[model samples]
Target: MPVLHSAIHKIDKKPDGTPAVLFLGGAEQVESQARDDLMHQFNESYNGTAGKGWGFFHAESGAFPLSGWLGKYLAGVGDFLKFSTIAVEHLVRLMEESNLTTGGHALFCHYQQGLTEYLIIALVQETEAVTMTEELSLLTIKRLDLDHIRLAARINLSEWKGNPQSKQYISYIKGKQGRRINEYFRDFIGSQEGIDGPSETRTLLKAFSDFVESEDLPEESAREKTHALVSYSMAQAKLGEPITLDELSGLIDEDRPKSFYDFIKAKDYGLSETLPPDKKTLNKFRRFTGRAEGLSISFEAHLLGDKIKFNPADGTLTMRGLPTQLTEQLKRATA
Candidate 1:
């Protein structure tokens, strides 16, 4: 990772709605091993965090002017330190307006990973810890709480510059459902939700299922394909990368590399070329298949507890609310 520029500022505020104070960093950070390590750790945590939403920046205007300031910095109109100061000032104003008094260290990092450039903005807090000295004396210290990163956003500079019309170039922690806690932070960055992670993942799975059904593959072949999909998706998630449809299709079947991709395109699933996989949905996605003497059964793993139940002691499977088509066929056969 090559860090172009980095800075950390401080926001002092209390939870009792006290006035906020902004302390801006005087200069951009110099390249160092510690800086590199911090960026790496932050990336790992951000990637592993769930409930992140992807979107593009809102229009650069008075209300959401961070992008304009960033544009000036990127265009060589001002130094990074100046730009970060202005940005943090805007954050302070938003925090005050939102009645959000919680404050911490705000980190801004501009770095390059591989051929792509990214800008990461995060608010990190510190936790106290006890450590023993070389003489065995106990000492207390404060360390960054990287494990519990709640307020952060990463902008894909490469994508935003290359594809101005793209809507999913910005990814940020959106907090859990029914909570608008991160709304102000999002407004500070001027981003809106463009893609629903869980919904998109579900759609991708549905498209995969349709492709399998259309191909009429054998049980073993289907199982292999399923494993290939899950493994590739999980690996991408671990690396903090999105699943590329074409690349995944090739991995699924080397002989017919474009088969799946073409199927998805023809069906119009409305999936982007690359999709951020939702780990929770992927974990719940699995196929339970069983075949015995003239008996075959298959269903999704998520349906096990709701529609299907298995008894380990009795070695039996019981299914409720059978499909209407199957029930109608059974009734006709009995009649």
Candidate 2:
């Protein structure tokens, strides 16, 4: 990663209805190996985190307009330090208004990976821990709690600039369900949810299933393709990247590179060219297949506990609601 600029500022606040304090860093470029490592680790954690929302920035207005400030910085009107200072001040104000108690060191990094540029903003907290020194003596230290990143957002500068009409250029961690505590952080960035990750993932899986059935692929071939799909999606999720349909199609079958892509296009599944994979939904997706001397069975893993029951000891499966065609065939044969 090539870091164009990076800085860290501190915000001191408590949920006890008190004023928040802001500590700004100097306006000098802070580039170091430690910074690189921190950015890399942060990217890994952010990529692995689930339940992120994707959207574009809100209109640039109000007391602390983030998009306007970012525009000035990007247009060469001010240095990154100036930009971050204004942004953190806005965050402090918003935190106060939201009555949020949590505060930490806010890190702003502008970096380039491959041909794409990105801006990552995260609020990191520190935890105290005991460690051993070179002499084997115990020592107390403060370390960044990267494992529990709550408030963070990354902007795809390349996409935002190149694709002016795109809505998923910004991705952010959206706390747990039924909680709006992180809404303030999103408002600070001026982003609204534009893409439903889970729904999109489900659609993709459904399209893949339809493609498999249409192809009339053997059980082994179907299983292999399913694995390919999941593996590619998970890898993209791990890299904080979206799954490109054409690219995924190529990966799924090199022999017929455009087979899946063409299938999806013909079916009109309403999928975007690229999709943000939902890890949770992907984790729940599985296909179970079995073939014996003269029997064949296949079903989605999710239906096991509901529509289908299995007995491991007896090596038997009890399925409800057989296909209408199969039911008619059995009825005719018995009659």
Candidate 3:
């Protein structure tokens, strides 16, 4: 939920500058249902049992026990799966075309499975420009099972401090760096070690499986810190005051000696590398001003500048000067 919110909240005109979403569903069912209805209408012509009642000729005659419903349901489900696959392929193609993106895009799915079952899938990609040349993309895959409950897995596809986006079609930083889309899905559904993927991938898959089995586990990752930053910003914007870096970390129970930003960069998002984020990584994203006595540091998003200023002395941030677009969002949120 947090990921989805961060991906699409208050953002308009996705990086593609278009609809960014390709929806496919129920296109053929209209025609098929029409044909079935017409046939049933004609069958109704049988007036009495002396001849053959409509029930005698077709499965539609028995509404409860249904005749052709099984076949129809299966066909419909097949079409849904087919379209969802196509949508993913299209999304990947779009990502390959644009080297950089500035918004978010996603594919949502919910299709019938059986008489009482349904399948749901959502693939999301949220992008934001961190600087002139660098961007951050959060990629997520979610699904709902027979219980109609949703579970998800996410990968931050952003490049490391010195790294750049790959020119190829499929790259997932730590895991599946150059693997294909299908390969990613296969590895996700199958075995983790089969693809030799990143630990984050394994963790997410385990989390998803555990959720389905009602064996959920606690998850702690550098990515959680990214979401924490977003959460902290939203809170600060609402309170109209800056909270100290230590206060922010304490609120989230992130007791690590190194900053969250630095830890994330060091881990490379749990890709192949493992390191804590440092001042260098922090400075790359923002201007980190450290306090000697308090041993606290404050940061300002260089891109946002004065709109979101930080005071290291009191360890509070004042967003009164935030950009017009973001201030408007804050107003809408608080309203």
TM-score each candidate: 0.95, 0.93, 0.16
Worst 10 residues of 1 by lDDT: 174-183
Which residues of candidate 2, in runs, are more than 4 Å off? Answer: 321-335
Candidate 2: tens digits of C-alpha lDDT, residues 1-335: 89899989999887677898888887645678888898889998999999898899887889439889888899999989899998998898888777778899999999999999999998999999899999999999999889889999999999988997887899999967336667788888998788888899999999998888778778999899999999999999999999999999998998999999999999999999988999999999899977779776777788898889999999888989887988999999999
Clashing pairs in 3: 174-271, 242-316, 242-317, 262-277, 262-278, 263-277, 266-275, 307-321, 307-322
TM-score of 1: 0.95
lDDT, each prediction: 0.88, 0.89, 0.31
Per-residue CA lDDT of model 3 for 171-230, tens digit only, reads 111222234543333232221221221233333223222222231112333234434544
Overall local distance difference test of candidate 3: 0.31
- Candidate that beats the other on TM-score, 2 or 3, i.e. the better one: 2
Q: Could you tell me the C-alpha RMSD of candidate 2 in Å?
A: 2.1
Clashing pairs in 1: none
Q: What is the lDDT of residue 298 in candidate 3?
A: 35
- Candidate 3 residue runs with Cα over 4 Å from true position: 1-157, 160-162, 165-181, 184-335
